[model samples]
Target: MYIPDIYKNENQEEIQNFIHENSFAILVNQTDGKLWATHIPLILDKNEAGKDILVGHVSKENPQAGSFSENAEVLAIFSGPHTYVSSSWYDHENVPTWNYLAAHIYGKVKVLNHDEAVGSLKKLVDKYEKKSKTPLRVEDLSKKTMMQACGIIAFEIEITSVEAVKKLSQNRDKKNYDNIISELENIGDLNSKQMADEMRKNK
Candidate 1:
């Protein structure tokens, strides 16, 4: 999360959109003086007072599930596509580098009650299942199934700070940047294509 001034992106709307697009996040916290991490999908939400919140759940059996206490500090990382940029792609001599996008969110964690957990599950299902041919709705689950699902520990993080970076070769000259984009697009891989798209957007 060490973002240079040139690479830092502080646009609130853009940051929020990026989080929504890349909802899967790495949640990190410290427990018993040791670091712990979990990879999970989280939903970005807003409170009645318009404060940003992150919602997610962990299995009750997960040790991390017990780490949440009021105002516990945690970090959530939303990583986007990245690819290696060869120096050969540049018009002039240069070293190879990486082009990527990522956001780091620091927040205070809060555990949710049973009712809130149920609502969080419903929202998560709706968000991900929207594009499915036969979309699954949380309401369609049997009472027992729903109860079991809600058995997981739901939590919310109130965002305290955001640090985002878009390292899309902004330091390169226009010609070299264009070349990188062109080469990446022609690579025809998911990560390369995504890097190309991000470069184009920033360009």
Candidate 2:
């Protein structure tokens, strides 16, 4: 994550909130001299010591899961809305650029035991199922369905570093920034609209 000083975001609360909202992240690791990445939902949590951590699991079938061990370093990338910022949006001459928000979390992995793994799975299910018309609980699953849990490897990532980046055209002058937001909203796509909103908040 090579971030310029102007784009670097040091606000801890904002960074954590962004991570939670974009919980589905790319988990990156290396094994056998090969790099691997897995996309999964990682829940934000706190360990017994009250330090922030991430709880998640990967399918045992995923080759990336083969490298999990105590203190293995991993990187989780959480991405948010982004859109192309055409140079035309600027008041003066400038090159086109992309505006987006993202967070990179570097941490050490801690594999969970069987019981702890299942508990984490249960919590994961409960959180996503909460808004369902007929919410389902992990306990509601039959023994055969529950057997699927055995096929996953749960782990916790003790957060060691967080690099938060929000390149929302903060360097632009008021007129250019306002024009960019207006153009983004006029584009009418979900991502562009979201980026416009983010720019407004940042403004």
C-alpha TM-scores of all predictions: 0.96, 0.97
Candidate 2 lands at a TM-score of 0.97
- State the local distance difference test value for candidate 2: 0.92
Q: Compared with the true structure, what per-residue lDDT tens digits does model 1 show for residues 44-151?
A: 998668999999999988778887763289999999999999999887887899988999999999888999898999999999999999999888989888769755
Query: Per-prediction RMSD in angstroms?
Result: 1.2, 1.2
Off by over 4 Å in 2: none
Cα lDDT, model 1, residue 162: 95
- TM value for model 1: 0.96
Clashes of each: 0, 0
Residue 40 lDDT (model 1):
97
Query: Residue 198 error for model 1, in Å?
Result: 0.9
